[model samples]
Target: MNRKLIALDLDGTTLNDVQQITSETHSVLNKLRDQGHIVSIATGRPFRNSHYYYKQLEMTTPIVNFNGAWCHNPSDKDWDYGYHKSLSRDLAISMLSLKDDPEVQLIAAESRDGIYVHGDYVPYPDFFPDGVKVSKQLSSETLLIDPTSVGVFTNTQQNQSKIEERIIKHYGEAVEVRTWGGFAPCLEIVAAGVQKAMGVERIASYYNIDRKDILAFGDEENDYEMIQYAGHGVVMKNGNDKLKVVADDLTGKTNHDNGLADYLTNYFNL
Candidate 1:
């Protein structure tokens, strides 16, 4: 194999049921490194949120976080110099216009913190827990700005699709709507063309690894494009079907079963 780099998505693929790495994964990864392969993470989480996990795995490669909004080495003291996306107050307000629709949940994201809600009237100070910073109430009356990912939640799958469709029809040109997780109808808005693929591409380009020589593994709708760009993409058995379709081969085991480690050990002869 001409593979030199590998990008692994965190959620449904790498992180298991208890939200952690498998021992077998760590062992195999060490073995891979002994053979001179590069490994990295492509995730939707922020750097702070991902630090503990990175340390736990003893990861030294760049991390693609916030769906590729940030791509830098979290291990470095300076978190400077990486790709990023910032959502403005106006976009938050525009999203607020649709809050009357019970199906829509508007959220705004800040470069530094947890999700926030958008509003007009003064909500109960306790509407959110302490530590979540609100943008502030505008004089326009009844408007509130909270940094969060807008979502459409419903008990009914069909209604979920309808709601997603609505958001796309209205904001398709403005923002990108992505279905979160495998087979989950919940939708989250991200910067247009922003996903792990963007981050992975940036890192690969910097290292001069051609797209076809890069290996990636993932298991969600967000991972679709990532698999497309990598040369030796693998999908966990539990991954979303779309991911499976593009993966060069199927690992045939889930994270709970230590599938990734098993596949690497055997396929790469590590």
Candidate 2:
């Protein structure tokens, strides 16, 4: 059998509704790895937030984090093929300026140091991990370095759309914007041309795996490029409707029902 490279998006995909990987999914992934298939995570989450899951899976392959703004092999300190793309400090400052709008409740920037939040807003504790500092100011002077990604949070869907539109219009060709639904109204802004597909392509090239031998799984706007790039793009049953339209196939079960395990079990004939 030809070994394949499998990329998984964490939230609302591999991870269930309760934010835990089910035993069934875990076993299936382990079985795949045992069969010599390479499995890696491609997520919009930062390294700090996604590290726990990466460790849980015992993955040695490079991880795609911050929606492809950062990619690195956590297990290999000597690996020099890592990619870390960030928005320019000026562009980051432009994004941070959105906090002035009343519709924009909060804005945050992620860097190697930590997540710097602007304005009078607070994120959940889980959003900030150990050693990841959380600051109240994200000014140009304070942001000594460029940011991997910037996030805008709004109180309503309408506001979310407005902010996204405003930013995209003002920062055209400078950044990519994506919105998240179902939970809080939020938008993730990253450097131009940054996408999960880029990370997948880089890893595939490094491993000498053809695109046709790649399988990707995702469920949200951030996963768009990756799902389209993969030979077999599997979208969750509970995935965004837009994503489902472009997927090669859809899982019969939802995330809460072990969707990933069920799909891989049949696909690999495990």
Candidate 3:
């Protein structure tokens, strides 16, 4: 096979139920890297929460974080061919209004600057690395810089959807809103037209690869655009039903069952 680019979505597609990559999956990925295939992460998580996995996998490729709101290569400080598209600071401040709703628990924003939170809720506590803190309160005054993404965490799925509708209705032209799948009931907002595929495309160009050689895996609504853009869009068996409809293939097993590793092993004859 030619040198293919593999884009992985972290949460429900790559990590198991406990949020750890299985040993079987790890071995297969390492073997692929040895074979000269490019592997990179495309996740809705902020880099702060997803950095451990990137280093653990020993990836040198650019990673798409915050669902492609930010793309940067952690391995090369000198790599200048990446982008960070952030929401206007005023828009981020305006989003804080959602926090006033009874069902909304927290509203947060993240950027290379820092994490700003309006409430105490930390959705994925384990994902955060040590020394990283939710230090600043999210507000017009404290949120001095534009954030790559804004998150609204709610108490229930109904309320989450409700808030998503409200955001679309109000800031339809300014942002793109998506609800997270599997683990939590929250909504993710980024600049209009921002998606993981954009980041993947940039990385593929950096590696001199074509779109037909890209193999992307994901399991959520946020993964929709990236999956559509990839030549081989593989969704986990446990992925959202709507995503499965558009995916080119589905994994034989769920993420917890080492589904990605199994499929890659057979697909590449590794």
Query: How many residue pairs collide in each prediction?
Result: 11, 0, 0
lDDT of 2 by residue, 30-144 (tens): 9999999999999888887788898888888999998898888999977787889988888888776676688787888888547777866544444665633445477877888
Off by over 4 Å in 2: 119-125, 131-136
**What is the clash count of model 1?**
11
Residue 260, candidate 3: Cα error in Å is: 0.8
The Cα error of candidate 1 at residue 77, in Å, is: 5.2
Which digits, one per residue and each the tens of the lDDT, describe model 1 over residues 167-227? 7787767676666543334455666667778888887876788987788988777778888
Better of 2 and 3 by lDDT: 3
Model 1 misplaced stretches (Cα beyond 4 Å): 1-3, 77-81, 97-110, 118-159, 182-185
TM for candidate 3 is 0.96
Report how far off residue 84 is in candidate 2 (Å): 1.2
Model 3 / residue 188 / CA error / Å: 0.9
> How far is 151's C-alpha from truth in model 2 (Å)?
0.9
